[model samples]
Target: MPPTSPALRIEVRGVDATEPAVAPALRFLLRLEADAPIRALTLTTQIRIDATGRGYDEQARERLAELFGPPAAWGRNLSSLLWTQTVTHVPAFTGATTAPVTVPCTYDFDVAAAKYLHGLPDGEVPLRFLFTGTLFYAEEGRLQAAHLPWDTESAFRMPVEVWKELMDRHFPRTAWIRLERDTFDRLYAHRVRHTLLGWDDAVRSLLETSGG
Candidate 1:
């Protein structure tokens, strides 16, 4: 519950003027270490700055606080979350400040993600939000680890970009849906004609493998 070490700013080096809005996310992607821990200097999700930190959006802090709990609050930051999850971090200062510990972070995508997706709101979300990475997961309302990483493709066999965009445009509110016969048939036909991979065969294999 140690407030992400009082959310502070540090003069980071090697960060380009144009970096991904999510630095940690970029770090994970660029490195992609099997279980390597990562550290980066970026705007704190907990600290609210009047000035936008370079490429970071001004509202990122507020938005994150609203979606997740207050990460800056004494007991609600990532440090506390990681502690609860038993992910170890090295206590080292960086860029004139001590940030989240640098350690090899592990992401067990398959297990943790299956849990998160089962409960997320089924709604029209921007397709841009979709990406392949380990998302933070705290279960039983308890933070589980540094994160539960997932290759969005391997984790979910669905063509998420296409599906999400379609749903966002077409099905804004409905959930638990089964595509109509005509629609499914059309999609299946399109898959057969365009993509060499047989949708039915691949899907059937996945279903059988998962025991679904």
Candidate 2:
């Protein structure tokens, strides 16, 4: 007879920003439920943004057009976008257990996930987590291992306010943008020539000069 594998279920409980970290990070609490005793487990999670899971206002549609194209073509353009992947270790547990999954967040506007997150006005961000890995358990008085099934997945609706507040706490009225070295040199020179107190002033002056 084939060995029976343990069926594990995972759920996202909540999300919060980790304090005193060198980089921006969000921690996800995952609750794992299992009927059999799980000696140990390794979980790989693929996080995706379900773009079509929620409604979008006109303003949001306009902002996201660059990513998903025009609202008129949303049926074809909108789809789940891969956000990030993470691996977590689960210790021995019986019945149920919870683990903290720390996911790093990037503020760079060049990232599609970042742009999509920032573009949202207000509402919950629909997220889907695809889980797969290895599971260890005991059966017939002997230890055994089995592949964590691919069909295991979880969905969570994260409040936009949480993301916004996390960014505000870390950046506080500041936005990050990457520019080519030449462009940066030119901007630096302009700031020096104008004796600008900050980069903001230099950019503002250049915009005004160009009638932007």
Candidate 3:
């Protein structure tokens, strides 16, 4: 008879931002434990921001108004935000092992997760890491494969400062926004006509002109 697969457990140790590079990213440290030796592990993780798990101050609530509406209506409006989904390969190990799951990040505020993250002024961000994948092990002399249980998951409360630090490392004290080509053309023309020193000057001019 074939042997039954051993149970596995997953835990999130911590999270941090990657060093300055062409693209920004966050690395989540994961610890995997098993009753038996694992030949290899193909891990897939879906990370989510539990927006409703943490309390928000008045300032944060106002900042997040666009996403969750006003604080008065938050009970019905707030929901989890999907941060990212990524896959990683875990090397062979016995008992327990640690691995990093790197998730690429973006400064684009158009993304809901980014918008939600940027809205927070302080405190931790409640995160849920849902794990699913295949595990390979040895039985007798032959190798065996099995699917990780559906219930495999971990919870983490990552400090908002971690994300803010990463962004500050890459962007300094600046923010990014996207504009349509036509809109950009108009803004560029205005900049050139008005001899604006920089993009910020051009945008500030338009905002003042429109009384925004």
**lDDT (Cα atoms) of all candidates against the true structure:** 0.29, 0.93, 0.92
Which scores higher on lDDT, 2 or 3? 2
Best by TM-score: 3
lDDT of model 3 at residue 33?
Answer: 93
Cα error, candidate 1, residue 52 (Å): 34
- Give the Cα-based TM-score of candidate 3 against the true structure: 0.96
Q: Model 3 misses residue 191 by how many Å?
A: 1.0
For model 1, what is the C-alpha lDDT against the true structure?
0.29
Would you estimate the TM-scores of all the predictions?
0.18, 0.95, 0.96
- lDDT per residue as tens, model 1, 1-212: 53122222122121111222221111111112222222422211211111111122234444444333453451443221110111222232333433231212112223322222222333211111112212232234443333222222111122223333333343354333356799878768766765637656655655677899
Predictions ranked by lDDT, top down?
2, 3, 1
Relative to the true structure, candidate 1 reaches a TM of 0.18
What value of lDDT does candidate 2 attain over all alpha carbons? 0.93
lDDT of 2 at 146: 95
Compared with the true structure, what per-residue lDDT tens digits does model 3 show for residues 1-212? Answer: 86888789999999888665678898999999999999999999999999989999999999999999988899999999999999999999999999999988888999999998899999999999999999999998779999999989999999999988888988999999999999999999999999999999999999999999
What's the C-alpha lDDT at position 58 in model 2? Answer: 99
Of 1 and 3, the candidate ahead on lDDT is 3
Give the lDDT of residue 137 in candidate 2.
97
User: Model 2, 149-170: lDDT tens per residue?
Assistant: 8789999999999888888888
